[model samples]
Target: MPPIPTPLTLTQLLNPPSRDGLLTQIVSMLSGLGFSATDWETDSDGRIILQVEAQTLADLWQAVYKIAQGGYLDTATGDWLTLLAQSQYQLTRNPPTQTIGEFRLTAAGGVGPYTFNKGDLVVTYFDPTQNNKALIYRSTNAAPVVVNPGTTRSIQVTADSPGSAYNIAPGSVLVLNTPRPGLTVDNQGTLQPAVATGAILNGPFFTAGQTLIVTSALNGGAAVGPTTFTFTADYPDMTSVANALNVLIAASPQAGRITANVLNGALSLSTILITGATAVDQITIANTGTANISVGFDTGSATSVSGAYSWISEYGQDNESDTSLITRCINKWATIGTGTKAAFISWATSADPDVQKVAVYSNLFNGTPKAGAVTLYIAGIGAFDIVSGPVHANNVYAYIFPKLPIMTELFVAPAARNTKDVVFTAKIKTQYNNDTTKNAVFNAVQNLFFRLTIGETLYKDQVIAAIITIPGIVDATLSAPGIVSDIVPAINELITLGSVTPNWLVVV
Candidate 1:
């Protein structure tokens, strides 16, 4: 490994003389040799010949300067920087990718089996903050049909562009851009799962001891059933296994005709409440012995559902900036041995574009040291919080898995949030609208917190400094953080703006 070179600005590395300066020097040299300086004047034809020739020579030198700059690391940009990153360190800029998620569209009152074609769009309501710009999500499913009237169907949609500004918080994306008659959309964040309310058995009953229990919330007089069955996996929850669990419930008393509080989305067998088949304790197949199956599902309600707002999956990134590519190229060289701190960060940073701040805790968990263990606390652009979610953590872990050294254990989690509300009173300039000034102050504080990294300390004065810098704010004072000091977070924690309450006082 070669030693890193000293950093130098473009102007410092090369001083390309201006054409006028070069021309003046050329005239000065000619005049010193007894030639008339007036001959090179801009107004005369003789001047055009000598001056233009001098300018041409200067232009060639400037071109040479820029071409020479392309050979260096810090001063290079555009294609020059791209080649440096590629050739010297096997790296390339990440192209922009759109955010995509599976969203559910429910009909208000429809005929049957409505198709949301692959290119169909579901858009968020217009936002006042973003100059009334709305996020548009185009359906990716070839044919997402709602078979039954008034049923909800899941359609995968991709954002028109990768903008993570408004669709991150739960219920933040409730409004639709345009109304589709008899159809409504729900775009949620970090969801548990959609409710598969009523369940029923379709075929012959299960063998003896096979019971279908409903443990989900009882909406519209639906009762919570016995807690007889345990969940198969802890992460996926009941909804993911709903399809499989619904198929295995062939003996439940509730078989078909489930029609109460329906999300009208996916089919949950437990939500099926048909009443035709006789309850059998034991049933045998043609060549099989008595079957035993105990299937139970939660008709539980949803808070955060699978939506376009989750930002849970891929963090679609725009093309890498020149500054970022150069830094990554330099960092790439540090990852040669593959177990260094740089290796982990380089891998995680490359995972997605939203990945802004990543804190690496080597040989430590909960502040306790454990040999051969690495815990990565990551925070990125996400709905509801800056911290990365389980899905993202899993994806990051998978990306870093192949790069780990022998016998190294790795754990990845979203950075814990240290939320703080900013409470202050600001004297607003009389000309500025009180509401507008208040909103600006709030945004100023929030934007500051958003830019902070994991384990960074937030100075109370810095917060006050940020608010006062707003053009509308005449004067401001911080009160809630009564002591007036810096708020330091744990290494694995990120400071997030919870709420901003600015008491505005108008001043002439």
Candidate 2:
């Protein structure tokens, strides 16, 4: 039989005598040296001057033990652990990063080129689960500001603070708190305006050569322009001018279904062009003609209801935990080569705060392993697809390219998601209501899936334990997963949470 090795801490390995034994020895030696207990005051532990002497010696031994422990990865604690990571691998704790989202702005029937400036504020609704706290996001200077030739514009916003809590769903942040009236966040889909629609232009005919310029949404939107008839006939009346412009538009084969009308000196230009296309037609009266008059085209007011939706570009991350930091620091040991698999994993994770999981493989395209060929499969905080995923792939490639080993073929890709349905039937204790207990069971299932790493297996036993251990669930059986043992994913796949179907109402 082989012998089992005993565990040893630095303090234990030193074989230092007990504090009590040391105290007793000190007291005995002092007594022999003719010192009396009355000479030194006694503490609550019933020791005299001997106690202080014994404790000081014990502390010295512990100091030596801690110093030795600090030099090793397995035994170091707190700030000492941080120092080892810093000095050895140049690694610091990962800081939390803020999420960047694209917030769009729209105004119905408005003027040209509206600007939503940098530092504009947008916020999420107060969530009850977060103690009624609302997250704020601000527009960066890089956000687009021009609304020229169109009434809708999109802008970029950064979360006010760094944290995963700000990685909210699309359309969740609709409050543009920057005080821009009539400009909205993510409701542009509701406006439902027709094709080639233009806001009414308030005007009486200005001059002999005044003309309206029309741009179509057909055949790549060729412009239809300057009427050939009755140069001054429509002058001095807005309705006459609109009717005249309508004639010119009708004369052009391009403006097939376009219409123009005037009411109270406002000329409205619109087209019922083709249904189902959701048009982008423009009715700007061009000032390029011989008429010396100013022109203002008003597209109707539009809220962002239809035009605005935000998705996380760079997902925010929570501060790294001690365990994750320690694991990374250990991986740094393998990164000294800059070409090892560990190096790839370490650098890929460090590429972005949102990169939560990374899977590394050699020559995934070929069945046989090819030397120096590596592909990294990584996932962001939420909703990253490989073929059409966000910038996580770009961010990773940019970061890892320069750091790669010479002549090594490296490919970085977002991990493909493997979504699965969570279904279960459970027996519940009568004292606990089925609805509340069923919800708890689903939460347990979600938690299990949530904690799973990329490419990890989902075991049936784990599911059983999770549900059965719940306070109200007496037992549970898995269903609809096609197997009762375990669900496994490909090496390049990540398990994403899907729909949950819990049939907990049945008594059995």
Q: Tell me the tens digit of each residue's lDDT in model 1 across 1-508.
A: 1111257455643676667776677677777879787545468886777668777877776776777777778788888778877777777776666766656677765554566566755566454356546556666776654435677665676777865443332223345554566666764322222122221112323323333333322212333333232233322322434443444343333333222221122122213222222111111111111111211112121111111113234444556789888777776677887777777887887775466678887885323355886777776743223222544555677788778888876766556555555678878888975444454565566568767988789998888888898786778887763315688765656765543455778888
Q: Give the alpha-carbon lDDT of every model.
A: 0.53, 0.56
Query: What total of clashing residue pairs does each candidate reach?
Result: 22, 19
Best by TM-score: 1
Model 1 accuracy (lDDT, Cα): 0.53
Give one digit per residue, the lDDT tens place, for model 2 in 198-296: 222345556465544444332225545433323445456666766677767666753564566643233444544444343233333333333322122
Task: Report the poorest 10 consecutive residues by lDDT, candidate 2.
Answer: 301-310
What TM-score, computed on C-alpha atoms, does each candidate reach? 0.56, 0.51
TM-score of 2: 0.51
